[model samples]
Target: MPLKSTLAVPITDDPSLPVVTFRFWLISFFFTALGATVQQYYFFRSSSGTYSIFFVNLVSFSLGKAMARTLSERKFTLLGQTFSLNPGPFNIKEHALIGIAVSTGAGSAYAIDILSATDLFLGYRINALGSILLIITTQCCGYGMAGLLRRYLVYPAEMVWWSNLVQVVFYNTMHNTQDFQSIRLIRGWSRMKFFWIVTVTVFLYQFIPQWLAPILVYFDWLCWIRPFDMNFWAFFSSISGGGILSLSFDWTSIGGATMYLPLSAQLCSFAGVIVNYWIILPIMWMNNYMGVKAIGKPLTTKLFYEETGLPFNIKPFLNQDYSVNETLYEQGPPANMAPMYALGFMTSFMGLAACCTHVGFFHGREIWRNWKQAVGSDQEDIHTRMMRVYPEVPQLWYAGFYLVMAVLAAVACEFYVDLRYLLPGKPIANMTFKCYGYMAMSQCNLLLSDLKLGHYMKIPPRSMFVGQIWGTVVGCFFNYLTMILIINSQRDALDGTKPDANGLWTGQRVQTFWGSGLIYGALGPARMFALDGKYWFVYYGFLIGFLGPIVLWALSKKFPQYRWWSKLNVAIFAGGLHNFPNGYAMGILVSLITALVFQWFLFRYHKAWWTRYTFILSAALDAGAAFTGLIIFLFLGGGLSPKLAVNVPSWWGNYYTPEGDNGPYLAVDRCGAANNAWTSGAEL
Candidate 1:
């Protein structure tokens, strides 16, 4: 089904509404600081949480209104321009600006991965100036790319960027004072009423799963049926096993962009999850294919030694300068990953290759037409026509910004570059290269999404540009500050010396990042993916990815009557499959169910209710879960004082008894015997 513009976003705008007001700057920075700190803090935890823009929109609306009621409207002249502290009213434009800034700053800076991985894993800390420069330049490069590509990605109506619609609906529900027709199914409640109701309800209920009874987060009840059975637990454990028919009551697990992304896309992703987790991983583990029995579990994110079941030792492989000791590395046993981890890596390769071909096949002609049309002359809809009143950002500004950022990025990267190998084995240098090279492309996608939001809201391009710059700069500093504090305070827990009793400081995120540094930096791809290596087949994923979309495109063209063929997005399917390998397997299943209920069922049968309340419901639930998680972290989970020492009473539901080889986080799957080889029943 095609997306209806009137249902998803507003078709009209008010030029009289004040934007870039005092309300925008204050709320934007305050939340930026708070969001960056909280997001960075949660980055190390096993059940990581995101401080989303929906939370900012809900809280900032109140703050903006409070300012409007209290602040004096006295006009003042500054630099030959008149400005007022208070605007006429708290308008949607200011609200949109605040949301944009919060969204920009809320994400943990990508460079922090480099900092944490190097400092914790390699015992090498990057200097402060270099770190800051790396963060800023990497982020700014994306801004420039977004500005350059806005014509095709942001301006086209077909490029819906589905998740942004939730934010748009939330803004309209909050600011648009007109009452909507009440649905009897929801007990005659308006959108605003429903938003507050859902927010407060979810906020109160989140305590049960987040802290009181944490076991509900991954309610793998099937594991409880035969807790002593290794194969049974291996088949159904939501924490470490295949997670077949697992359930989760945790909102953080169930209530993300799942409620908003297109249902077809979610189904495509679910198909990937089914193939990888249920079929491929199980067959490999059960059959012990490719010496899989030596790797212990069928699914994990950790790398292991084939000779021993213990985690792989990368330290001995490194030389004084952190380069791979080729002779010593060659003599040692190859590091092996669980079949699931290896398959996930293949999916990542496939998704990357598939994305290129998918976009070219689906959108090549439209993009070419958009490129040929001049910037000011490519108006297609009423939104574009109304936007013509505001001056567009000049192309030269983006070109100059890209040039400056590119130079700064190179300079910062050079600070660590040794005058040795072309691609040095220095993990820090490897990370820096990855951040500037790969992360910049992701950043462009992110900024292009934000620019689409701006286009939808009819915001002036200049104001959106300034707000993004301000938010990004503010976020980078705070993210760095928080990372420093955590590393200093919880070094022992983060470095694997001491286990966090509450499971809050596992450093799993950095561990994953550091693992990549070892693979690509210390142990170059030549050795890791050699023709004779166990992972030689992984490279085939690239060919599979490239060909999958082309096949789908051909089928779609051949069977024009079959609309479903066109909707099956191969890139989305591959990306979705990769997400389920970790603890998110159950969550992805739950998310697909939720998408079916809202995006498909209600959307088809209850159009009025779906249009008015679906996005509101998503935003409210996210805000509630986030706010509760923040409180639990601060009060019960050791955010404020380390000595506070609060914990939930141990019971059958929340019990965690550490046995052999189960990773951090409690689960009912206590099958220590599964750690041994299935064939010989002996510890490898």
Candidate 2:
């Protein structure tokens, strides 16, 4: 079935209402400020988790409604049209735009953490303004790319992003009432009523695991069964590498992601996890093949160097200016990459491979057709035709936008030449090329996702471009501040090996981020993984990624009933194993279960109900969990003086007392103190 949509009707049927009001901007800024505070708080926690602005909707919507009533309806002429200062009433479009602003204001930029870790842990000095500008440019680079390709990317109807469908459904539901006409939805109920019921129930029940009994986050019964034997307890560990099928009772972290993904997509990722981590890596380690005996940890590059008794020595490779000395590095003794590290590095190649092949296989024809129509000015998409009333933005406009961001990016690199290796846009020898590979992997997905967002919400391309580019600028400032605070306050915890007094700050994710900057930025992939290098076999991952999609595409076309196989997500195969020094596998498991129960069963059994209730239920669950988590963090203290700690009884299940800060019993990867040969650098 051809996907169809119309924009003849306004999103709220009230465009004349005020949107750029004092109330809208104020609420958005407040939310952004709150998000910054939350980021700072979460950064110091022992657990590796992030908080999203799920609950902001409730506050913003309420305030927006109140402002709509209180503010006056004074008329003003902007150009030819009359506009109201009060806007007859606040609409969902206003709410969504504000939400987008808030999200952008507190958004994460990759460069912020990259610079933070490099400066704090790696002993590099990055200028404050340089760091900020770098973030702005890289973040905007993706948007400019998105704009250049908007004709193909955004104009198409099938570019529906599963993740963003929740927002689209919510907007129409709140403003438009056609869907609610006399239809008994899932469970022979009304969607409006059901959403409220679920929302309230979720909001209440979220207090249990988050506030009272935190141990339910990791309900590892295996540890309780054999408290005396360290080995038995270690087998079920969730944090370290040995999470071998551990259960997480926390619904927010676990099942929250599945609300968007269908069952087959979830299963594909789960299968990849099981096959790669559960079956392959363990087997290799058990045999001690490929120097697995020397592997220090899972999901790390630095540990590989440490394990080989030849940790990276940055002194020999750094110029007098503290920049990487390209000549010396190319000739220097190559760092020996542990097999485990090489295995993880292999995924990047697959990610790159999949980006090209996946697009070619699925949306190639439609994209081509869209391009022709857009250029020829015939049979433009319905969305594009509707948008013709507004002056069409020229491609040159996007080109100029790209130049402005590019110049800023280059200037930042020049200003902080010492940290130039971290700048992918810079024209450095191997560093820029290597960084571009990672950028392509990310930007392709970003452009596609942004297109879907615009298509779903009917946002104009020019407006979308402007928002994304500048929204990035707004986000980078807060993100930079958050990074600086986290780094300076918790220096030792920046690498997660050292446990703080409160056991709150863990640098697990930073370790991963810093490690990548160290390798790809400082050492360069040519020295680490190219021919004659230690990790040559890692290059084959690209072939695997490229071939996987081709094979899957062929199979699906030949035998469409077995189409589930075609849905084998290449992104999962490419990037899934690379994620978790944080150990999100428990979350992945819970996500799969939710997809099976909610998306597969319910969606198949009751179609209209599934359409109506799925997104609302998801939104409700996310909002509930996020709200509770925020409250607990702000009100309830941590470590010894935990707020509201007295509510729960002090038992094994309630309070997890550890001989070591981590592990139910032992570290999952069987790693211990590196006192023996931790700093043994290269045989230079």
Candidate 3:
């Protein structure tokens, strides 16, 4: 029996209901809003947004419910004919499973884009309106582009298995069955029980680390651990005494680093990380600090002059300071570093080369063959096959419509900001309007390229387009609005005690204005500067993200059954690249762990049960973590004032002071003297 069967509680479906009925909209709004809120909170608190994990759970649970109802409607259409797969009411379990599948695609893309935009533009601040706008624009663009490219990417038999979808299906089917229930024994529970347990565990873990840590979670303590120190000696001694050899378990240094990856890709990525962490960021930080210093101004002097009249202080560092120099060395404690530019250049070249070689070698011949087949050869092209699977929509029409919408969105943004004129004495140049149009175009191009890749793999184009569209629009519009609102609310937090030489808020608003301006001028470099001057780290991160997928692609080539590796690649890469402070590591670990457990159940016993139960378990865990995070932030953390505050002894209390009315907050005093100040001017 399918795992879903075991967990199958019954429900109903009503197709007669309007697509945008109040209930549907309400549910969508509530879940999306909750996700938006939590993501924004994390943005301000930790400077990283954990949207993927949060949304995965929300969409899974909600969609599961919706699927039950849809199944009850008992209507099926195939090849323009209505037929009953089952004689009576639709199987609630099957419908739920399908819902899980679709929801995974929808929610993952949604969360990814949301977090990406906030991380890139707003520093995770809570701007409800801005966030919404960002989300809507990005999602809309993504959808349109995906639709255009879907005919090529999704529909071929070769693309039957996307990694994330397969994982969802496999987990749900395998765990619910009786025969392979022992697989769940690894976690030591039935599907439902395991779900609850993991959910609680992860929730507690994420919250405690963020809220109750001895020091601010953002500080890089691990980087600052000196080898010759007494603390280090004690730590080593304790580990030795406890029979736990640090070297034995240190995965990074161990062969485990290369164990699962292709040698070339691994080496490139590892080298990239080294360069990012050790070199580029340090240079950027020194440059920025020295730039101000050279001008005979404190760093804070630049803050007040910023657009929002806030102080510069650490807020800019926390918000969007991802330059080559800022992202890497500037983030944590001072360390002996190395040159990064060379390493980054080398790795980037390697990655580009690898992508070219891999695609050319594996796909080039196929492309030619398909072209020949399309011209009336015996072999049919993938595109032709896909077209048979899903008839093409009028893509040109959609593209034109997208263009029109892009113009309107730009106009709306300009109108909102009242930037219709170029300068004090110039005619309305529409420069801002043109720039937005360019942004829309760029988004569309990215969507098209990704969709094309999907089409070649024979995945369903419609599904791929759907995911991208939702992601793009949600990311661009709603995401933007949310960020704006959040930033406004926490204006004080962002503006540290420094009066810019000109006496401005120099905090969040300055970063936002300058960062946006920089981004507009040069996307890659500007983003680097905005992120943290840690340009090398992001460069390295992108390489790492690309490598994981390449490895998975290679594995799939070697072992076709491991086609699921491709999906894993996307999940792991997305999880890691989109956040910082070892977010990628966390994503990789969690996904691999989940994959292992899921694989065991599917291979050893009932496949059906494994599919359903795995999804349920993942959803439950995600939901728990999200809600718990929300509660901790809103209540224990004094509603985001002191996210990392803790209540401890006076000695510890003296070591840290609460940012707001909350208890002692995380203090990394040694990191910088300016951190002690309440305003941006203190740094100046």
Clashes of each: 0, 5, 138
| Prediction 2 TM-score vs. true | 0.78
1-684 per-residue lDDT for model 1 (tens digits): 245455778788888788899888898999998888878877765555556566677678888988999999999999998999996789998999888887888878888888888788778787888888878887778877889888777776655677778678768867884443333327777555677788899999989877777667667777666654555556666655677777778887776577667788888988888777667766776777655666556665556776666777778877777677778877977776666666777888899899999889977886665455534454485666778888899988888888998898777767643313437355556766787777689888888888989889889998988889889999999889878877876777677666443333567667767777767776666666788988888787799889998999999899888878757888888886686443445565676788898888888899887776666677788777777876766667655666654666665555654531223323433332432323333222
- Which lDDT values do the candidates have, in the order given? 0.73, 0.57, 0.37
- Sort the candidates on lDDT, descending order: 1, 2, 3
Better of 1 and 3 by lDDT: 1
What digit string (tens of lDDT, one per residue) describes model 3 on residues 643-676?
Answer: 4533443332124433322222112211222223
Per-candidate TM vs. native?
0.86, 0.78, 0.53
**Cα lDDT for residue 552, candidate 3:** 59
Off by over 4 Å in 1: 1-17, 48-52, 76-82, 127-129, 150-177, 180-190, 362-396, 414-424, 485-505, 580-583, 657-684
